[model samples]
Target: MEEVLREIYCALDQVLRKGAYINIVFSGEFKHRSAVTFVVKGVVENYFSLKYALETLAPRGVKPALKPLLMAAMFMLKHGEIPGYAVVNETVAFAGKKFGSGVKGFVNAVLKKYPTLPEPEGIQKREAELNAPEFIIEALEKDGVDPKTVLRPPASDLVHFRLGRKGKTEDLSGLETLTRSEAGGWFSMPDTRLKELNASGKITFISPSSMECVNAFGDINGKKYLDVCAAPGGKSVYAAEKGAEVTAADLYPHRVKLIEAYADRMGVKLNALQNDALCRRQEWLNAFDCVAVDAPCMGLGVISYRPDVTINKRPGDVETIVPVQKAILSEAAEYVAPGGRLVYSTCSVLKAETEEVIKDFLKKHGDFSIYSYKNNTDFGRLIMPDGKWDGFFICVTEKKK
Candidate 1:
């Protein structure tokens, strides 16, 4: 248990000190059979809260090494059911071994005095519980978050499957359900469910929402289609499945490889290549009948799945993504045939990335008209954060002959 705690602390320290993403660094490291799994998960989930707590509690003159131990101990001390004295003693011992022995007493002193720090009302907040960052909270506040609408913990897997019996899509024969939730319209299933479904001859796995966005737009007729920025190629596979010959392009080779791997898994063929989506090569500039541009932007829409992004994302982050979104949209417009449909989409709800970007693109190219969703989707249905689906925005435009 001590070793597990030390590993968690060390990885967390690396994330704080070296600017590593916590999810990438801590993946699979927290798995253990002991009761400490709860403790470890609690610490990781409330890491930001702990940071806030330490900033509020630690003495002004404390050294940086001592701060993490203090942060970890303070988090466990406040949140863990263990008596405060035992937490302090164990953490002091942890600090002596992890840091130098010289810092152990200081760790003890800080833990001893933690009770004196005035607890902020927000200290009780956990990261996993909110499932979003402070900016999202601010955004929700601006949009008016309803207390009644905030999601409660979901039902057990078996219960959700029972509810699914009322619906036609679920096949509830012989299956071991791992998780279930009704947060959104669909009963959210864990990857285990997908595995079970796949075993029963059901499939279609898309990593990013862009693929789903393009698939949601128009019909893919097996004609040659170009997917610009086709990393982890969800759209390419979707198109290929519908008989479209796909040319998936990414600026980086590694990303192209990911696209190829997805194609291989789905038993679909696509020409995956590395190329700058912005470059106007004469051979590529006016090519292809259909083009899909899943442009990158501030990922405000999918924050529910990735809670840590909001902690790092700022208002300025939107600005950095806007110019890029415009560049790709413009470049993709050129590739579409005179009458071919060009899809512009983002897994972002921010206006700067969605409507504003598309609005600006249409202004520059009056030759293209915004394609209305004739029978495909409810084109104007704004899926708010409080809603089932993540915040997503899609626009389809067609080049005029």
Candidate 2:
């Protein structure tokens, strides 16, 4: 138990102070301890809630060094199956050894009063219960999204995958399929079986919204396609599967390699290149029938999978990313041949990333116009995260011939 707490503290310190991503830290430090994994993930995922409770309990405010311990202890006490006394005692002892006897006394007093603390009132209560940051709450409300609906912990550990070459759906038997995409080969599966299937090259994981983005491109048979920011290439593979002659490009060589590896494993042919998406390439001007700018943004849509999107991200990040997304979009547009399709997409529901970026681009480029999808509005299609799918936005535009 002590070792588990220590591991949680060390890993969380990297997250809170060092700005390391939680998934990378967890995979490296805490993957071996299944029990500790649940507790640590719960604490980090519900950080604002735990911090709110701790603030009410410890009015002087907890120090950064001790916050992780309190947060983990509070999570265990409120959410874990462990006995309360064990949670309190073990945490207090861990505090004493790490901080000193004085800190231990402070921890003990606050935790002993935890159960009796009054419930937070109104918005704070709502915020704590939802485990949502104020900025996220405000943003969702501004976008007409009900925060309660989207701020949920993922209900299941199911991973979505598409069949690779030489793979059949029957090869992944015994797994329940939650949803199937119009692309025909895509389906969801219990994440428990992902490691074995992923290693065997029978399945390549992709988000359902991403699958939909590829489908939004309509028929790509024999069409020349450019994926401007393709990395860890799921969408590129999907485009190739749809019979597009795909060329995947990213800024860094390492990311380009990921696309190459994915293409190899899927038995698909696609050219991978390392080229900055923001730079204008004269040779690529009007060279492709379709262009996919999966521009990088705040990724608010994927908070359920990557909780750090809320914790590590600042409000300014949205502002910072807008121009970059616009620049990439402008460059990607140059690559689309006349009458060809340019699909601008992001794993973000924020209007700044989706509607605003496209709105701005349309204002500048008279040659392009929005081509609506089935449920799309003038702004674009904003797919909010449900229990099964991550939030996403896709807008397709056609260049005037």
Candidate 3:
């Protein structure tokens, strides 16, 4: 238990201090230890709530090194299968090793008092209960998302995957099906089974909401297509599989290599290029019959899969990305041939990143207009996290002929 607490301390330090993504940090450091992974994830995912409780109990405040330990201990005491006494004792022992006998007593006293602490009331209570940030709760409320829904963890660890090569879905065993995508080849399966199928090149993991963006493009058989910001190449590979003559581009060479690797594994041919989405190439102007700009954003919609997003993001982060998204969309519009379609998508639900960006872009580009599809809205379709899938906002626009 002490060792797990130590590991959690290190992982939390990286996230809270160094501003690293939790998924990347955990995968690199603690993926081998299932117990450590579970505890660390639980602590980090519910960090805000734990912090609130610890701070409430310790009016003088806890030290930085001690905070992670306390948070982990608090989480274990309340939610984990471990008994409260065990959690308190192990934390004090761990604290003694790191901070001497004096600090150990401090740790013991604080944890012992945690349970008797009065529960927070009203919105503060909701924030602590959900372990979500106040801003997130308020934002969801504005969007009409029940705060209770966003606060609860996802229902399953199932990941969506697109069948890369022709094979029987039944051949993949041990996975429970959640839902099938409207896109013919995609389905959601348990993460373990998805990893197995991905290893054998039988499948590639992609969010179903993302696959819906590709689906919105309709039939692209034999048509020229450009993925303006393609990386780790799920959408590019999907388009290629659908018989589109695809060209995938990203800002960096290493990212383009990911596309190449996916295309190789999937046995599909597509051009992979390293090009900035914001830069216009004269020769490539009006070049493709279909273009997709999956612009990067704060990634609030994927918080279930990547909890680090919440910790790393700031209020101004949306403002920072909105212009970039609009810029990419502008450049993407230039790449579409006359009468061709441009699909703008983001793994974000924030209006600034979604509707506002699209709304602003439409105002600037009078030649283009919104193209509606299933689940359409005035500006675009917003798919919120359904406990089973991540949220995404996808908008399609067509250039005037």
Worst 10 residues of 2 by lDDT: 178-187
lDDT of each: 0.62, 0.82, 0.80
Ranking by lDDT: 2, 3, 1
Model 1 alpha-carbon drift over 4 Å, by segment: 10-48, 59-74, 81-83, 109-116, 121-188, 191-193, 196-212, 374-381, 386-388
Give the per-residue lDDT digits (tens) of candidate 3, residues 148-263. 65556466656667677654677555456645666554555466656666877788777788788888888899999999999978899999988999999999999899899989
Candidate 3: minimum summed lDDT over ten consecutive residues — where?
182-191
Whole-model lDDT for model 1 versus the true structure? 0.62
Q: Tens-digit lDDT track for model 2 on 1-401?
A: 88878887888787866777777776684544776678768877787777778888887888888887887788888888889999999999999999988898899988898878787787777767777677777887898877766676456556667777757867766667656665455556566676666767778777778888888889999999999999979999889988999999999998899899988888889999999998899999999999999988777777777776666666677789999999999989999999999999998887888898999999999999989875566867888886457788999999999
Best by lDDT: 2
Evaluated at residue 214, the lDDT of candidate 2 is 83
lDDT of 2: 0.82
Per TM-score, the best of the predicted structures is: 2
**Cα shift from native, residue 187, model 3 (Å):** 4.2
Report lDDT (Cα) of residue 249, candidate 3: 93
Clashing pairs in 3: none
